[model samples]
Target: MMSNQNSVQSGFLPIPSIRRTVSPSQALSRSLATALVLALLIFVLGPLVVLVLWAFAGEWFYPSLIPQKFSLSWWSTVLSDSHFGHSVLLSFIFAPVVTILSACICLPAAYAFSRYQFPGRRAMFIGIFATNAFPKMGLYIAIAGILYATHLMDTFWGVIVIQLMNTVVVMTWIPAAAFSAVPKSLEEAARDVGAGPFRTFWHVTLPMARPGIIVAMIQAFLASFDEAQGTFLVGAPNYITMPVQMYSMVTNYPQQAAAVYSILLSMPSLILLLLIRKYIVGGYLAAGFRMK
Candidate 1:
């Protein structure tokens, strides 16, 4: 106590320089990590940035980093084209139809897999999981051959079937997880409180699983709308959609027109993604794989 009174007290630490500082290696590593993330984002978004630039570039040349002139002529040409309009119409029609059908067919199946026990259930789940584990091009080819034999190839319905095939795995796997994640006790509580099975499910179960279902639906819609390889193989000459049309534009139309079309093609998915961004995270969709 006597020494304490005689001690030299400072208002701040003498080593203030080192107080909030990281070691050199940590700082370097943090800087490098930030740089790598920026590089990766640039790598991914670089082409998209160029597309936006090229869409408005009227007189870009090899030496120019930016366009020498800018104009809205490309947007006009793309918007005015009959083929672009038709492709848009077909995409809007087909994507929604595929999403609805997938929900109807797969949502019940997901619920069954989640809530019921049956013989061969595990094996059936594995089979469904494995459908998306392989490269889809080979499957598309096999399906195309089958479609040809079945007299379904090159038809609108055939195209729908092809797109729907892509969606089955997503719809089943994600919603299965979502449905399985719902607490059994809450469902039971609903039933015990005079709720019927359907009412219990509609009120208690469905709301809890809605995020996963929405994620599944969004994935299905985008898969159908953006699918090019299957659509190309099955519906090329007869039912050319937006993605398939992009192939033609790349080879035939000016870069600017293709850029404008690319932006337009991307708008719907982007808009939807922005609106319901929360549901698209992996947690809602991937937390349900331990079904016994």
Candidate 2:
């Protein structure tokens, strides 16, 4: 009986040893994962962090691990400059207009694409996606010619129009996913409750799609705000944008220009992103849940 008990005890002893062995392996995996994530974060964000530091640094060129001094002189200089002020004002005005226009143009198309089985729908989507594959620079000549012909060249409207073309595709794709998440049964229930198409859309559909719409707006706004090539191509000489102004200043006043303009330009998108991050995450989760 003592031998039998000893055998059972010995068998149970390995269990703890097995657990101890597995724990290290699991810990190693978790450690590796954490290390990988940290590495990636540093890799991606290191440059931006450096840029921000450089912007604030009083003087930085070579052989400097850190700045000797820090001051707001750059900010003061850029803000006081008329050219920077004009460019910032122009960007602030143009970005929202482009976003709104893109949303207006895309919403209907997105609705049709998501809810209906129209002819050549997939093909049409493919075509739209193909546009992104092409180098946008290739189309600049054509765009410039059209803008010149329409007498919109070197105007704010020209930049808006150019941004609109790209924004619509993004805005539509985002909303279409949101729209598709709305159950057919819900629409039928609204109809059964004596709700017309517009009423159902306004009351039921729009609320559910709000997150996606916000995300689309954020995307469109960022696209419009950061647009350099198209704006430069179209609005050169006559109208100056923030990016254009930044480019011009880079040669003469790299530090001050990068410091002030980069912060100013990045602030809106960063604020917007922070504001809607939760909604964007929730929308994506809701989309996945609806799909299942």
Candidate 3:
């Protein structure tokens, strides 16, 4: 017995004592923090777990924590739906088109915000930000009224305009901060060496800001891609995008089909986020206030 104990003790590291010198307050704080994190995990991930189960469940019922059987029929049904392909096409078209348009409009605004000092500059920035900071349902309703007047209702441009609204704030703010971070001296040095203002900006300033711009573009794409509420209000009958299709599936289709569809809707945004995960850091975002 002594030999076995000695061998085991020598082979493996010793375990620490269960008793610790931690203060009562510290112990309470640690326990509270752990509980909070656990709660947050449940809040965020619990539905996802349920959704994933429902997507594959063959005969799940009440009073059960798991399915009786699992199959790929849910996925097959979701994939086979005629509207599925159309919804995906609409999402792809809308997200990228809106992203491109947003980049064109907001990038120049971002550059101006970073480089120029004009009247109402801060106010303009605030106004742009306030569009997103406040509740959007009201804005969508108001915009719907205007669209009705302009005969833009149920039109492609109308839907594009709505999705574009969500992208504006992130697209402008991040790139503005990025452009502000580019050293003025480098741009000046390029100009001094015979580069024109535009050339200098292209070569020196823009490349340095590419990371933040990439991050912004990804955000804009996701925002437009995931947008369902406004799209539903305007484009329901004619232009049902993927997210909007999810809304329809929730009420009209089987819960399992909806689960399968939800995961499909989420794939592009998840893939994009994972691809650009490194660039979506807080460093560039924190530079927003540094923009003058």
Local distance difference test, each candidate = 0.88, 0.79, 0.89
Error of 1 at 59 (Å): 0.9
**Per model, how many backbone clashes are there?**
0, 0, 0
lDDT of 1: 0.88
TM-score per candidate, chains pooled: 0.91, 0.87, 0.86
Better structure of 1 and 2 per TM-score? 1
Best by TM-score: 1
Per-residue lDDT for 5-99 in model 2, tens only? 76677688977757766999999999999999999999999878877887787877678877778877788877898988788888888888888
The best-first sequence of candidates by TM-score reads 1, 2, 3
Per-residue lDDT tens digits for candidate 1, residues 38-133, read 999999999899899999989899888899999999998999999988999999999999999999999998999999999988898888877787
Give the Å error, residue 159, model 1: 0.4
Alpha-carbon shift of residue 128 in model 1 (angstroms): 0.6
